[model samples]
Target: MITDIRLRSQQLVNPAFNDPKELVAWMGALQGQEYSMAKWAVGLRLKKPDIRKVEAALEKGEILRTHVLRPTWHLVVAEDIRWMLKLSVRRVKLAYDSYWKNHGISEELHIKSLDVIVRALEGNRYLTRQEIGEELSRAGVIVGDDLVGYFLGRAEVDSIICNGVDKGNKRTYALLDERVPPMKELHKEEALAKLAIKYFRSHSPASLQDFIWWSGLSITEAKQAVGLIDAELIKERIGETDWLIHHSCARNVRAKRVIHLLPSYDEYLISYKDRSMALAPEYYRKAFNTFGIFYPVILHNGKIVGNWNKSAKQKQFGVESSFFIPGIEVDEGELDKAKERFRVFNKGGND
Candidate 1:
């Protein structure tokens, strides 16, 4: 049986971290290139209120720009990205750089490909991989999709290239000089320490497994972080597993009957390896259903009781929700009752 408090901690302490300053530092950009891990961290939620706060945080330098951790874009803190990449690079090598080498991507070719992309984008402001490849082939590189796309992606990581206008079709590349520089640099160890502190601060009352899920960092990095952190924090051991809570923040942690319409990869839903606290075992399959991998869900009183979507029909607007856990199970009445909320929430959408 999942306790409401446990689930709240899992999703972040009920009235969750209302300060966007606290949460946005963990992720990177709004639009990421591949690296779903980075994309997932700064997920796109369905609610305007939720998005507004995240965007506000982006405007602040609390989140910095560094291609340190994931190969692709991550909206990590200005300080965290520098050290995060250094700490996690070896793991990245084991995962990608090494694997890419096996696939014929020598260090020389990697450098050459970036040159190819930069030469292509030198004069032209926006160009696709196909366009970039044409120039690369002319310059004597293979210019295949593997070469072109991967090279362009890495160029973004190198902080020389980034996404630009769609050109009425699909993605194109632009110089980072053209795109606004979103963040600054921080010392490596300072970044790591700060990242750990941010993780524990924003998402309090969490275990090491939770940090592993949230930052996508290895156990070594996670434990090192847990060791270096210094703050008013409390630990609660539920048997062999223990969770760290921000003593300063969680002091007045009050439980509220919340209906957080979290987005697909909302931090609360995705930032944990073992999610038993917020989601039951049986409902796991239902959450990550086979319907092409849908976004996770909204929790009524901490347990994910249903899922919701936005829609419009006949010029009238409405939000639809399917309750997973029966309402009678949680309450004596209608479980996960969202129909009335949707009706009220969607009225302004039509007019």
Candidate 2:
């Protein structure tokens, strides 16, 4: 008796899906959560929720702690980032090396950049983007305007950036050695296998292509990894592909009416390629950024029906911002549920 793995993953983990921090913390790198306390929930494509809830989460220590993966300012859990980075550092290096080569940065210069960043940022408390750029400029090198950003990204990929202290719209980096508490080392192979298993266990019913995208691995490596775990996983044909999932997933998928107003750079959209299950291709450009980044989306019946974001006065906390209905007919159930979720997100004021 086969069943749906997506429902199973949710049940095994977030049955109610209430604690976003828990799932996000495990994945290691969710971009919007990286830089801002709260990203514009661009999932539905409209900017919603200013800055009230984000502050509240931070105050509650429920969100906005230190962590890194994907070599970016990912706002993942403090506890999970260590393991997530352990799993993804090699991939980050691959991205860094490829991007560096494309940019024509010499290996020697790369080493020098690392040295300069190490010295400049070490022991420094917090720094703004402009400050980082200035420091790089003083090191007798010109990376133009995006100098600091590119190099800092490089550092992050190299497992050097450990912390991103928020300073208004800007962020400062901390040495990985300083910010993150020590963790046991993981073998490269172990990390690869563990992450592959984790993603499958959490987000099942996915193809190899989906795994490749989520893991940031080349198609070849993705295939190899899948081969390693294929025997242990259960596969079922959905459309043209055999989606892999754990045995326990997808047991009871009774059209659970869930309206989730997720943040920008949330995992659901980015987790798979065949998103038609939740969204239509025509709305891709509409619901996502110019870069194919999915915006904050409204999910009804386990699918994206619209997009949204919020405007914050000081951009300090998350809020229960108002909603605007489109010309299309809206489901009363989904609509009310969305409003209730938004109210939960915004607690009447900032922290």
Candidate 3:
């Protein structure tokens, strides 16, 4: 039942937005550690999925890829990045501090490195991590490959820089102030309420614990956030658990047989802390590996029935599916249509 609601809430059943930027804004932030696959994550939720359109939005800074929500990369719209950073950066900094300390990067050195990075990108120039590291090295700061990412992530959470257009296959960073236009800022409580609403609205039937994990907030803070918007949420007792769904989210939608080829790290699976509603414990290993990798999953009527992968040979592209359950009933015609949609999304470009 929750998964059925999620199909509509996540825009997978009836995708409402044609523009990727608006869609990213609606979902709050999408996990984007896997760059190209993450674009497919966005494409999977569009009314008219287009990989090139997502790339264009990223290139134009309509949406940004940076370290936020946790210590990983997430795609957030330009309008919400400032407030979202302010809301989550403290926890993220705490998560990253150990890496800085172990690498002998002191507060003073970190500040100096950020200054060098800012100066290097001052003239509207987007520089790759290696180029930024070279700038730091030229300025007499010793920055190695292992420590470069931590330093750049530091700048990103500090609101100094964000993702720029990619150079071929390499990623670059630009000054945040330049890339994002100024917008009205929300205070701490307002931002928290806004984020909580967005999470519950798009990812409903989740628990307070789920919010705590996704927002990276302490239990006390998480409770306070839920309290702030308690009136706007619906509390339901399902089995042994108490679930929270946004009051505005559609409920009790009739279930139908549907098949979706969800990309790895898509929000539908990653946004919640407890995945039992969709991912069965028996087949967990089949969809997720020991290395913390979530593979592309096959969703059939609100449950993960199988997993899928992409393959490329010369100029041709294809998808391979593996059903975990033996002799599971799947419409070949629907599966073919799903694969064709993915192939069309990848038609003009490699990504």
lDDT of 2 by residue, 1-351 (tens): 112345335332235333445544444345555344234331121223324544444333344443243444455555555566656667776666776676778868778877877887778455666776777779887777665666777676566764455666555666766665666766666566666776776667777877887767767767776777776688778567787875545544554445666666666666676776656777676567676655666655565667655546565434342223345455766666565555543543222
* TM-score of each prediction: 0.70, 0.75, 0.96
Off by over 4 Å in 2: 1-21, 37-91, 97-104, 227-232, 311-329, 348-351
* Candidates ranked, most accurate by lDDT first: 3, 2, 1
Which pairs of residues collide in model 3? Answer: none
For 1-351, candidate 1 gives per-residue lDDT tens digits of 224444443433333344444445422222132223222234222232243344445444444333445443455544444345556655554555655666778879878878767777775477866788888888888666875766765665555765554454455676655454545666655666767776675566678887776666778877877777755467777767787875544344456655644445455655566767777888876666655253636667767776766554656655566768765344423333343333433342232
Tell me, by lDDT, which candidate is best: 3
Error of 1 at 19 (Å): 8.8
lDDT of each: 0.55, 0.58, 0.88
Point out the higher-scoring one by TM-score: 2 or 3: 3
| Candidate 3 lDDT over residue span 112-159, tens digit each | 888999999997899999999899899999878877888899899999
Off by over 4 Å in 3: 348-351
Candidates ranked, most accurate by TM-score first: 3, 2, 1
